[model samples]
Target chain A: MTMYNQTTDERVDKALANSFLRQATRRATDRLRNNKYKASAELGNWEEWRAAGEAIRKNVISNLDYYLNQLIEQMEKRGVHVHLAKTPADAVTVVRNIVSEHNAKNVLKSKSMISEEIHLNHALEEDGIDVVETDLGEYIIQIAGEPPSHIIVPAMHKTRQQVADLFEPIAGHALSSDTPTLTRFVRTQMREKFLRGDIGITGCNFAVASTGSIVMVTNEGNGRMVSTLPRVQITLMGMERIVPSFRELDILLNLLARSATGQRFSSYTTILTPPKNTADPDGPEEYHLVILDHNRSEILGDKLFRSSLNCIRCGACFNVCPVYRQLGGHAYGSVYSGPIGSVITPLLEKDWKKWGHLPYFSSLCGACSEACPVRIPLHDLLVKLRMRKTQSGHTPQVERQIFKAYRYFFTREKTLRRALRLGAHLQRPFVRNQRITGGPPPLSNWTNSRTLPMVAPKPFMQLWADLKNKR
Target chain B: MSNTSDFISNLAAKLGRPTPTQPPPQVKLSVPQYQLSSSAERVSVFLQNWQALGGKGAIVRSEDETLQCLKQWFGEQPITWFKENSKALLAWDKLPTIAESAFSSLNWPLTRYSQSAFDPRDRYSIAASAELGITGSDWGISLSGTVVVKSDPLRGRAISLLPPRHLSFIESTKIQDNLFNVLEEVAALGSPPAAIEMISGPSRTSDIEMDLSIGVHGPIEVYVIVIDH
Candidate 1:
């Protein structure tokens, strides 16, 4: 699989060049956006529901330790083994230890962002364990050896024809772009893997503190198969993913479905408690929950940024983001992408230089904040990250000098007017039809794709002054 | 650490958040009431909505009709059947024809005690690889076309989820007007049972390449038998 921790620029360039990826993303996002509109409108009191969901998430995060302890106690009572990991390494070690004890060779995974966060698939594959992602989107991306471009729709960037072409060689059959034919082929191929899998790995959506149940909402049945058929089941969850009770769960579910797919509810909402009794025929014999802190605890402690942990991974912010609309999730380079990713990735990783550019990718339109179901101030967080970056002296020297000059010019109206007049005269060489078509190295990147309006001939302030004098 | 009060106090102090003053107000939970025009009309409206959501439903008047429906459905598809150990099911004597391995007579009270007893996937297919699951629903919501089943020792959650096709036998008397009405009824039962599942239709998703795939996560085909006994 492609490493998302690096190669943000390369992926973004590739995604931009691939016409099919851009078209498919636009089409799918449009449909999802429409569905969300219809579903949320139908529900009535959607804002109220969003508020309740936000409040519940905020409350849970503030008292996360208490909830975690309560969840562990309740889960243990239900015969589930719970392990808490302070970091990604700790989480991997805990999972590796379990796999070693079980001697598991084959593992089936449901789509989980946390697993993606720690690069669990590579870790398992390195150990010679065959880990198969059972969700169709994850499966397609898994086979192609790429990280998910979109959280909800992992392979949204790929077209059906591309998927057919990809699967044809692997399945040793002529595959078609037809939906039913492709699905049937995948179902047949995955059936064997499901039945034979020694361990089922999944991501936890919400860990119910009251019942100690791991709540998973899926549109596909692979989660059920993975959880049931395998003797051992492992769930990796971010520490912040907890809800107080099922009652609160109802409110969140309503908001999540509407925000994610515009459905009243997902096709399947599975809550698996421990295998109830030996006499009970189905469910995993052993259930293991790996709760990974992996930077969330620190995020939880930060008063200004603590609200970021309240994100439910719905990808609603990504959908409505103007910058994300032009450039997909791959551009963000982190496992968590889009506006939330900008806030999350830098905080999660120690390598600041690699992920530091991510926060600046946004235009800070506040669309992400408006779209955020949990009411996270994503745009504000982006600005804060920029401030932090600047304060830490991470900004490039040339850019810093340019911005310092801009500050001086903007502070004085005379200097600003003179600078604007000088810029208009200097643009004479590049101006074509009153638009700057070419410029110096850095400015060329902006002018090549888009026309830079010629410093607005006469400046708005000058025009207003002329109008006042004429009156 | 050994003392429960000390554990609570220390834990509360560590988080630096105030402990609840009086044990967090007993969550004031209430199920909103929705009124329907009439029972018969409600059932019709429910059936329409169910059919609109791509689900199939049929009304059976008697036990004989129920058996006939089951036999016809099984005759069409490869299936293995398991019967609940309830007196009502036993009176029908539907067990003799199926192979001993195919049909097991479960203990009724024990099955009822455990929420997962009726789970359909537990029994290996008796006649053929089981593709269709058969069960009796505890209640039905006509407005939402939802079937509400309480998980008990006798009833398995898998019975509803595992198979590609699910056939539920629910009574007409149990059909409620709306989801709210069903929630109210459930609340009246006191301290909601261990599990209460509201299944609408076959499991589905449009996640894979944005193509709608039925039975992706849950049963693809769900059939509801509304019996008037």
Candidate 2:
């Protein structure tokens, strides 16, 4: 399956139970969380930094149209080609045209969610062009032929042994499960692709409107290698990913690294201005920036949800999300998954039938909102999306009927009290030793993995009324 | 290719929002000011603290001492020395005569540089990658023992990133009382040229199966040269 699309909840449940995935995800996330804590503590004024980051993002998104125009003007002035794609299809077509024009047979890609959003890899491969993912996590998923399971740690679901098994036949070496050995093998294998690839594609972490430059932050120098080694460099950025100036980038970078992985800084933050002058020998001769609106421009002007565009893709929401912790990213069935995904996917894809159920996946705990670096009120947005979905008639008929019956019973107090008393008595067979271990057909899904709490013998309100009468 | 206006119109239609006639509003929030502690002991405390944060540092009295330290730290190993073509570096005593074969300048564009310089197989023991990776520190944050490297052509974002070992030279006077102080300094500099990166230690990640891997994506080794002169 492509990286953007995901399997259903049942498939995700099976994946999450896999002892290997649970161990790896838990370990990696724990360490990342700890390091982030320490790093932020060290910074001393992390809250101020976060506030500054949020303010800067809020400013840019508010004036996105103007900055985008300014960015286009600057890029064009520098002789860098800029393309604006309104849809994922439009984005794919633009990239395909560039690849076809360059006769690109092998395309080396840096990790870009925009490319994933457009399914550019599948598009390129369909045209018989070999698209190789060079990021270590992306590389692992590409080989397994699965979409990324997490935003920051794409291959968070895979074990090292699994990676070793996948690479052994390809490398013709007895690669070990040891981190160093496996990483070393991938490095050797990817180096050849970097040197010979026809095009280098990357995602823009932030685009500087003032200079027409795209900023990419990475720990691996692959971003640098990919953007620099190839004859052509193409960057795909969401339209809302613009910042007015570099000074603003400083604040964002502090928050981005700290919130995403809890590092003082990513090892490398590369900013490529239009190709260097003729006197310079080391950059792509052809530079292209694809500004994708896919659905971001709409999110920008939205009153309740425009703040969603302020996301830096730090994956902080996913890391802290309780539902994501249980179901993993695959269940969300979108390139952007977890709290951010629930809000964004529906907005991006107008087809609510496919994505409408996603917003309900959250428990409305507000943990995602707290974890968000740019301070996007992700939980509120998820609830709003759910409301929108219902208003748009995307709710299933069965669910609507169930809620309708509940609404009728709950509006009248006498009916509600009688129903509760009857529910306690009727649930006796299903309830054993104070908890419902097994239930009727409709409630079976709840009891399948979770036990339902035993209903009290008497309603609390009724008990309170009896006590008052005795007094 | 579709015209730019068509793309913008299509985007507006998809988002179901009114087409913005002008740009969105720019909100200018007052950035908080950061003041450095004016204590004589703060500098030494900062240095000691920085060392505790996995950073290596030393005080050199003269050029001779600098060369001696270099020899002691890395001797006879094939090394890539990145020194500026500046007069100060040129005037160093007992400077090693790096043959044309030994050194490569950062003159190559980023792509060519990666191919020629990076060898995962250990073909080269060291790469004196650039003449120098000059960075004007956005003030060193004493509280965290971190230094911010704002991106510029002279700093060459890659200098701090690509090498297996990174050496950054900063003046002694630039170290500040805390991270907030640095933010104020950055704000005062107005808009930085392009990018500003706060580097604490060597490139590190615990990503692969929770194993702490140094240099997974950036330099494995990091050195900070604090020049008192």
Q: Return the top candidate by lDDT.
A: 1
Interface RMSD, Å, model 2: 5.2
How high is the TM-score of chain A in each model? 0.92, 0.94
Q: TM-score for every candidate vs. truth?
A: 0.84, 0.83
Q: What is the C-alpha lDDT of each candidate?
A: 0.71, 0.69
Put down candidate 2 lDDT per residue, B1-229, tens digits, no spaces.
5576676555455446645666555556444533455643445655676676566765444555555554555553323332331211111111122211112231211212223333322211112233222233545665556666653322234445444565555556778865545655654664343345566665554446656566555556666655555
- Stretches of model 2 off by over 4 angstroms after superposition: A2-7, A413-424, A434-437, A451-471, B6-61, B78-203
Give the per-residue lDDT of model 2 (tens digit) for A127-232. Answer: 9999999888888888887778888989888777888998899988787799888776766677667667788999999887876778887777678767755668
Q: Give TM-scores of the second chain, every candidate.
A: 0.65, 0.58
Model 1 TM-score? 0.84
List the lowest-lDDT window of 10 residues for candidate 1 chain A: A274-283
